[model samples]
Target: MNTRAGEAEAVDLQVQGRVAWRHAIRSLLAQPRGSIRMYSPDYADWGLGAPDVIAGLDAWAIGRSQTSVRMLGQRFEGLQRDDPRFVQWRIRFAHVIACHALPEECGGLQECLLLPEIGLLVIPSEKSRLAIYCSGARLHAAVHAFDQSWEHSTPMFPAHTLGL
Candidate 1:
């Protein structure tokens, strides 16, 4: 479960089922000090909208003034209906959290959560409810890929929508 590559310490955990995935994600969320980046098709099944997770995110965002959370997804059409708590959390932390939609030209993107400063990476599978937690040098490639996708993404899921 733990390995070392060069000077970096690495830990890997393979988890199955929704409960396990949520636990893994919560654990990863607890480790970040500076930033968090996440990518998913729509985040509908990831349990990220759960109350506890939203509370944890709220705590994390307040832990530091410079902390930032970036989320990129293929689409988020149903997020407001499916994850109202998460929507509210986003609204409260609008200055700290940002959501983006991946452009069609970007093609397929694997679901992941990356904490670059902490060197942690989480890759999750929605259909099977499986996830892998990886750390250390392995994070480099995932971080790079995420950065590229983020660069091509457009703002989405705004905290507030203006109504006339």
Candidate 2:
């Protein structure tokens, strides 16, 4: 299914077809960090507990160069930020996006865009569909959407800051 097209039928198919999604994820993991820009609504629950990928992101964030991760409409936050492993993230640019506390039907509490070089991964919730893109223009459009929602949200403590 081509998630990029916003087709509900496509998303439903992909969610039920684990084998196909698994292969796509593996391909994503194989890419170099610079070649990928990951945007997800929830980093805490992603990748089925893949330690290597988690560690790699931590290491990458710590370098003098900047690495960006944006969170949109997040419903829950994870505990990694307090861990020393996430120190790099604190110093870098991490944008958390949310709505203005709307009810769940309006797309729930979280929606994220993980921008990797290969494409954008949209993980709004569990078993959600992921979108792939190779163009910056596509990514930029997603970013704009995130920003629009983010602007309406009142400031709240990031889940990490709440000692989650």
Q: What's model 2's lDDT at 135?
A: 37
1-164, model 2: which lDDT tens digit per residue? 34556432222222223344444554454333542333334354344234454455545545424324433334324534333334333334243222123224444322333344334343443555543433355555555665556555453334335454
lDDT of each: 0.74, 0.40
Number of backbone collisions per candidate: 0, 15
lDDT of 1 at 70: 86
Return the lDDT, model 2, position 7. Answer: 30
Candidate 2 regions off by >4 Å? 1-45, 64-67, 77-112, 121-130, 154-164
Task: Provide TM-scores for the models.
Answer: 0.83, 0.46
lDDT of 1 by residue, 1-164 (tens): 55445576655667777677677676666545568888877776567776667767877787455528889987887777888878888888888888999987896666787886433334444566766666666777778888889899999989999999
